[model samples]
Target: MTTKSITIKSDRTIKSIMPPTKGEILCKVSGHPKLFLRVNASGAKLWLYRYTHPVMKSKHKLSLGSYPAVTLAHATAMRLEYEQLLQQGIDPKAHREQQIKDEHKSLASTFEKVAWHHFEQLKNKQKATTLKRKHGRYELLCSYLGDTPIGDIEPLQMLEVLRDIQANSLKDDGTPTDKADRCAVIASDIFNHAIVHGYATNDPARIVKPMLDSYRYGNRPSITTPSEFGQLMRDVETLKGTVHDSVFHSIKLLSLLFIRNGDLRRLRWSDVNLDMAQIDLQPMKGHGASKLRMVKDMIVPLSRQAVEILKAQQAITGHTDYVFHSDTATKNNIINENAANDALKSLGYQGTHCAHGFRASARTMLRHKLKYDKDVIEMALGHITRDPNGTAYDRWEFVEERSQMMQEWSDYIDNLKTGKTDNVIKMPRMRQNDIKTV
Candidate 1:
């Protein structure tokens, strides 16, 4: 092929080589024998590197980029590198293609991309609240490490990001924070997912997790003694004004049933059955807040006093969907989770007792004061109790025993409030019978 030998040394000289008036033209560089500048009739300029394969001796042209975008010096540098590859028995064209494929793969397996994939996989498995929190955590992680390739993230880099989160968490309270540790847990899960999917070779987050400040799970405040609990019950009953009707009934039920605060607040009219004297529903821990949700329903037998409180609550919020409907809430009809806690705080039970404390109180009192069995109380508390043979307790396994225990518990509460311990019922311990498997 015939070509024009162009003495292109600088941008000015390269720019001076204008498009051909008739068709595209290939102007050969004077010094660089393998490099040529191709100019088209449409005024488009391109740099091309022509080389011969080492084994086959076949000639091929590779693009070095455009004229203005890729300067003459850059083009010469790329030509030299390509010639070195050819000398090493490597085809420059194939090597360039492989590099491009690797670049695309790196972009696709970034931490942000892999984390989003993992988050999407949990959409159906998690509840709305859980999904929302996870999405927030993902966004936080992306803000720091999004552009980084998953496999490229090192343990030290992951630790730095976690420390930043922990540091930011202290801005409000100035106290030691567990945010970093929590974020580390999330990152570990994401890294583990990436490893399983082949996006990453190792979990740097897992390696860095042990380096972070250890987080401890603290239980909510509760009163376990009989006299103190009875005084708290009296205070709740006698407390007047400013409390919403829903909050009042909620506290009463929370004390009597000793179920989770979330379960009590989210109670619906459909879940409660006054005729059956039972509240047959799933606990809230298994729904959104918990990592592992209990699939089976929790059956809460209603005592005479609990049934009385429900009948009273029914007359007030019967029209609304929730049993404890919040009048001030705009987003949901249910009462705020803190409403009862705030009310108890007002009644001088700030750190001494909380809405959730009633569960611990009932568990303790039933076991010590009322002389009830551990499994029966645990079942009533919505806990997972197992038999001696390692079998999980069925939903209705201790229903009968729990029913009697609940009635006695309510009566015991009444006796405590009225200072009538002598009136407490002395009943024989109910024997476990008709054991069934789930």
Candidate 2:
């Protein structure tokens, strides 16, 4: 190999230089010591930075990059940077390797990767429905900021994501939905998990909560009056033998039981006891991030009407695990979450009554008209109403009273649908003296 001093003034000048006939040659760049343009016999040109190791005091060469890609100006700039590192007793090659290592680590610690890791840890801790919702929210955030490192995320960036969600994500009622707030909560949980595992230093989501719009609760639209509810019952009767036959049965059962939509949709045949006339459902009340935490499965006292609906439904789906099984469903074989709601919409009840509206209707009529015990009504609705000691009442505590209440409620609904005047006579409130002394 031969070395010569050459001035590479411009891009054209560098291209004009020719390679050696048999061996490689080095042309020193003007005004930058130890920086050489290496030309090979195969016509390949590369930039090399020859320097002494700051600690070892031995000469070494580092490939700056190739020519054309690494221009004359750029190669000299790298040579200057390496000289500064050598002055501070640092090896430029080792420094570059450390930076590469940090880049790889940052890629591995992205917000999306950290969030999924957190979810994996929660498999046994959270309920399936809650976990599914959390994952969906995480995905919304991941779509926007998945590539960002969790440790590098700022509060303002998180706020911007939340603002976008709040602005675009709307409900059928044309109102801002709670999806943004829920997403913020999930992001905070992910950051907290990342912090625990050393992937993040702080929770940007936690810092930005006050900056986002507060979610407002709205009552689901429902037919509150007896006449309107009776008409709904009649309208549902007209939907039998249609494509929504399963939803028709589900709607009828919703009216009779008034359970949460998720609980009813995910209801399993194994949970229904036809002989006992009750449904032992593991309610999704106290799952991940839910305020109302529950430790026991809710026991719903099935009314005669509800039992009849279940029996009819059992004949069609007894071979499947889910009572609302659908062969075309993508996830679980059960029906879609909005199946009953869509069915209600098709019945011209859109914006008036929904599948979830059944619960509110039942609560109002059962309280004002039926006059059932408040505790029994609440418990039957799968609400966790605690006693005086702060401990929740046992699911079976009000079973007998709820059974009577449920039977009465079902009979009243039947009376309404048939246009009968069988108003329930208010049961006399029992006093302490009414109880027989032992």
The TM-score leader among the candidates is 2
Model 1: weakest 10-residue lDDT segment is: 286-295
Report the lDDT tens digits of candidate 1 across residue range 147-214: 99898999999989998887777634466466787678788889999889888888888888787765
> Could you tell me which residue pairs clash in candidate 1?
none
Each candidate structure's TM-score, on Cα atoms with residue i matched to residue i, is: 0.66, 0.75
Per-residue lDDT over 7-42 for candidate 2, one digit per residue giving the tens place of the 0 to 100 score: 776777788888878788888787889898999888
In terms of TM-score, how similar is model 1 to the real structure?
0.66
Clashing pairs in 2: none
lDDT of 2: 0.83
